[model samples]
Target: MKYEQLANDILTHIGGRENVASLTHCITRLRFQLKDDSIVDKDKVKNIDGVVSCVNKGGQFQVVIGTHVEDVYHAVCKVGKIEADSSGEPSGEKKGLISAFFDTIAGIFVPIIGALAGAGMLKAILSLATTFNWVSPESQTYTILFMVSDIAFYYMPFFLAVSAAKKFKTNTFLALIFAGMLVHPTLIGLKDAGDAVALLGIPMRMATYTSSVIPIILIVYFQSYIERFAKKITPQAVKTFLVPIITILIVAPVGLLALGPIGAFVGEYVAAFFNLLNEKASWVVPTLVGALNPLLVMTGMHYSVGAAQAVQRATVGYATIYSPGALASNMSQAAAVFAVSIKSKKKDITALASSCAATAICGITEPALYGVTLKLKRPLYATMLAGGIAGFYAGIMGVKAYSAGTSTIFTLPIYIGQDNSFIHACITAGIAIVLGFVFSYLFHKDEEAAPVEEEVPAGKTNVELNRNQSEVYAPIKGEVVALENVKDDAFSTMAMGKGIAIEPTEGIVYAPFDGKVEVLFKTKHAIGLRSNEGVELLIHIGIDTVKLEGKHFEALVSVHDTIKQGQELIRFNISEIKQAGYDCITPIIITNTGDYLDVIESDKSNVGLDNTILTAIK
Candidate 1:
């Protein structure tokens, strides 16, 4: 119940769960790959209480939810009946290769990033401890702690296999077995001993795979197709055992000999190229990364950079490329947002900027980026410029992050090394913050604003419908009455459908929404309509007034005629109906109330024409 309303609202604005092709959450956002981006009500979603902001980029509809996004993600899964960790089958417009790659990368990495960060942080702390002699490296405590810290990174393929299997929608155990095969003691010993290993007479490229990233991902992707092909040929009688057997038999040799070697070569070459770039110019990559980081983040190409950085880390023990530049960029964003907080006069903007700045400083930047920097425009330029300058200094100093986690003030320990790299990283962050603040304070020009009253459309109510729901508007100006108080048993018992009775004063009925007239009584006293969204409504005028209904009532729309909201559908004389000695309390019934979870009535005792009086909740 805590997040139920928020979940429902989010699903409603995103065109319901049916429109969602897949859903995943990162550190601070719920990422949705949607089938129809056009129908999403982004403004409504952004205005939801728990939602910080909404973004559409890189084929994803992202709802920023702050640190507690996991709980909210679970809530969304529960409400939508979606399986946790289910990477749904692809459906929708075909994505470009770049978009698909980034999407795949995010899906595989997002689930494990928190654990990876924790493990990385532990390794960083151990590095700090050993460097400071707080614990001797020979101590048993140190040995165990070091082992614990290094385990996740050393056996990284095992972790990657699970996440990759989910992303590729393949068998997880098979993927795990594949990872086990790569990291098996026998294989590692073979590689260590410089022995040429052959499988089924095929010579294997004894590439080290314990800490490898690309190989397992490539293998799992290949296995997804091989597994599907295996399943098709295997007889159902032995399908369970034979399918996996066939898959492993086919996948093992091909993967080890071809895919694994190819992936390792690609990873090595990419890392080598980046190293060469750094060796020749030293500052070009860092400077460009810092300046373009925000744009990269917005396009979700940051994940691509992160993937390359992961490969670099797997190849070496530390990262000098992406993490250093990202640290500078993150700190710069924090400083720029802090400047905004100090400069803004409005209480809400100041409060928001202050909180976002704090979050950005802790290594999450989406809130600050979307809520403050990008919204203000100038702050983004300030941050990017500041980041670029800081990154150049970091590059020149040869600052390297010794671990993989968020780049933050607290994680600065990760930069600790045998050289002056740690101090240089600190100086880099300081430079970013100082330059970011000064530039933002100077460049920012607040826009003069004026309050504008919102205008409501003619013949419409402000009340909006949620998912699987619709609003029924008052057709005539009248005093609202409870349905139970009506004279009719069918309505009083809710047998006709859930609705409310209104005592009519004015007697013109308007169509509630775009719909078709399904029924018009010859007596002209009752009308039945179905909305475009499938809300079936019956508007009955006066109790048993059918005795003299045709005498005072006139139907403007005929049966089966299409009508629009606010279009006149009926006209009646209230005085004549009263003079005829009949109760003129008109009841609007949702004849298909069973189709909804609940039908709720507006609390107002009196309603004006076109005002919302009933809301059907799905």
Candidate 2:
């Protein structure tokens, strides 16, 4: 509801799209990497119609929109024209080395993770059927299901090639050609060769590319550079044939000789690193993952582990390190939401809690995360703490899944038909739910308490004439015009109630015969007041000054303060507002226009804070 206004308000409060380098969202928040952080008004953003909260951390501007974050994110993207990461590509402008590295990982992994999840779930089902003796291992049905589930992983290089091509902006077919070489039969057969194979008289090492991760990515990255250079050197007439030719010629040998081996080694090292952690400090894996899974899910970097863990499972018999923590984390989140559902009496909160609980139980945690547990803030703490405990238990019990898939009730079959690990998995989930519910139910009731209302002191204009007629003075010195002429649709269309607009000659706003300051935005770019004669007004300083984030403004008064005509309401600097590229056309409107029968406007061409801008008539 009111998504357009929410989008507009969000865009404005975050310093406009020009200030944004790029944008992304987790389950609940719009993560914006802004060009200038100092220009954002965090408080004003939190007060926007749809926003739940605002946070500035790790060089990102976060706007929490709860469950509908995706909708708002798309709306913001549409308004901003950001080439976002449904492609899972890092769409931000230049970032520091570390940020870029993480961004790249998220981009490359996000697009493929869904496919990975689907295949993993399929494998889990196949495992279940075979375990139950419903399908024989040698049967055609089992073979086909196995093929569908394993093919993606067996040929992960090809899929990664497509995604990496989009990220690096290279010729996709060229990248595929490069991936083809890595998994070619000759290369596979070369693994059994007694000696190194020669390519163009250069010695090349033999390695398995099936179920591989990094090698193709490296080759494709190099291929993109070669393709880019080839298009530049070759004639446009012969570009089509020449580009692929040059790319293959350059990428093939170097990939075989250097990058492929390096990437393969890197993948091995990554897997070995986790294995080392598992052996030396088994509990650390579960503890760290359980504590940070929610955060990892938000940045979308959790999928990065799939590649490394795939290598682990292929090299070893099963994936042990990552799955335990995932199961615990999911169960704990579900339990937390369920606890909160019954604790609250509010229908909306209860409905959200119930739905999210069901979602988490099925292994999809986004709903529980954004709509219920995290929304309340306290339940998240319970989930995290409980998850850590459950994960530690899973580690101690050596819980393992034959294959890595999402942690949900549906995935329980993956843990079954293995050694006693299935029993341990059940125990871990049970502990997670029990601990999560108890702690959350115990500590989360404070947020459900009824809010106390605050009374506004007298002195706000209530002296209604026979027609409830009142004179509203101008808030700023500027040219006066009808509200419909204002640039913003919310004001121009009178959706925010009828008002007059001004193209101010000065930056300071004076109280327009103010009886009380009903509202004043912390950003100081806007103010609301009730004049001594019962005229209510909403004075917005600029067309989108909300974007300037109070950079050029300062509040001179606070809410509920009584004031006289010509009293200074705010002080602002137009230079920064102008530099930031916002129109400083302010709107002064009657918020309760329906209360009066006729609202008459002034015929004056230009006026200051002393001029009567509108006459509210009843």
Candidate 3:
């Protein structure tokens, strides 16, 4: 609900719910398949408060929302009244093969990314535990944890089946049945025993499905068309059960005989290609990933590299391609931002840069990449140079990560398997940070530092400034809630300045004092007011009601309209808003709370329209 307003803003600017054909989300982005991309208001969406950035690439309109993207994605689905679909397949126009490929891979992988990362990290933790002899491998604790981590990779086809079924728009349960067949214990036993098998006298090729990726994806894709064909051929009356039976009967043998082996070959070839490249030119992948990751991230193509690494891990049980270089790149970005934070004289820029730098070091680099490095052109170059060199060093050292997770300083435990790999990774990170900071600080310039004021002239004495106090009355009849208790972090943390929330019992909002509306949101759920007494306040009608897109609410006065205390300002239908599943908890905030010594909330639990709610003391 906290992201509803942001979702609504995005939906509105991106040509509304109708323009959205299908929607999905990854770790940090809302991937949208819009019906008409040209009509999207990119600037408006990029400027939305919660959005980190916006990208139009891989045939999708991607809204970057950092770590909380899943929340925003659900909010978007609810607000836009659109079903969240994993099939980000284009519904409007055909796209280039590369774009289509990226979209397909993203759709198939995005849904289970959390599970994949969690399991990978758990695997790494298990490796660390055993390596350090903290837990005996024969212990039940180790056995249980190992199984927990192994299930994800061991049964990867099941996970892939579900996601691919959704992406290919096939019956998910049916596809799951197919995956079940592929990894069935009997089939696994036969393959393990090296026994020959045949379907109806035709030879069936045996290939392992456990921990496999491409075979299931190809099977599910093939299932989609076969399922449709089954539906068309079977009578409607018997279609329910008969269709599945017919589709499975036909596709099963073919998949085992042809597609399964073909997919295996493809997967093997792909993995072999990367392994060969790593073998022949070990520095190439790391240097390229290090230098170009930012560009790939900006275009939302980084997922492809991640998918390749996942494949490599599945194929060979270890990978050294992506993570090492990615670590160097992330560290470089962190260092560049930290350098900017240190060199900048402006408090706001320094604060922004410092926080973004910390986030980058934690391995979520989008904040630094989009917010700081990309904005300051020189810092991006500095990071690229630093990352490339560090990555080259890492490659030369032959560092390898034994697990998968976000590349971060703390995740170096993943490099524990290979002797000295963890040490090389650390050294690479150190090099990246040092070079990035030095290059950025030397090349990038901030605004000239403010000149120091001349010491107070001895001839002049400072004059005392007078202070004034003003009262802000209740804008609506409600049970008052302290700002700290508000659900929203922006309000409860006083990040948007001091404020008090209300659980409104009525449907109307009135002017708290004589004031003019400085700004009114298009959704009419919030307003900014400037009182005659110099108190600037913001009145938000409900939590996330902006998603209603102005429905169930009407503004009596527009922006710049002057009004007196107790005059009607906004009239909302409380019943209707509640029916639509929204909390009508209005927050009356002192936007300029810093200008006052204190903005005290009323002690009274309940307040009427005329009751004093805030006292702004200056």
Best by TM-score: 2
Q: Lowest-scoring 10 consecutive residues by lDDT in candidate 1? A: 85-94
TM-score of each: 0.62, 0.65, 0.61
lDDT of 3 by residue, 1-618 (tens): 788899899999999999988897653468788999999999898789977677786577878665456689889989989886735422322459989888788888878878987887998898889988999999999999989988888898899999999888899998998889888999889888987888899887888778888888888999999999998998989999999998899888878888888877887888899888878888888888888889888766778777777778888877777898999899999999999999988788799999999999999898888777887778999999999999998888878888777888878888878578889989999999999999999978875636545334455432211135688999999899998888655467665668798899888999999878886665678788889779999888876565566778788896666688999998999999999998888888887888899888899999998799998988
lDDT tens string, model 2, 372-491? Answer: 676577899999999999999988777777765788766776786558887888888999899989988987874544654534336533332423567788878989878888875556
Highest lDDT, which number?
Answer: 1
> In candidate 3, what residue range of length 10 has the lowest lDDT sum?
459-468
- In candidate 3, clashing pairs total 0
What's model 3's lDDT at 235?
Answer: 91
Name every residue pair that clashes in candidate 3: none
Task: Report how far residue 602 has shifted in candidate 1, in Å.
Answer: 24
**Candidate 1 lDDT (Cα, 0 to 1):** 0.84
Full ranking by lDDT: 1, 3, 2
**lDDT for position 489 in model 2:** 53
Model 1 Cα lDDT, one tens digit per residue, 465-574: 23446888887788999999997554675656789999988888889778888877666787888987899888888876655627788789876666888899989999
Model 2 steric clash total:
2
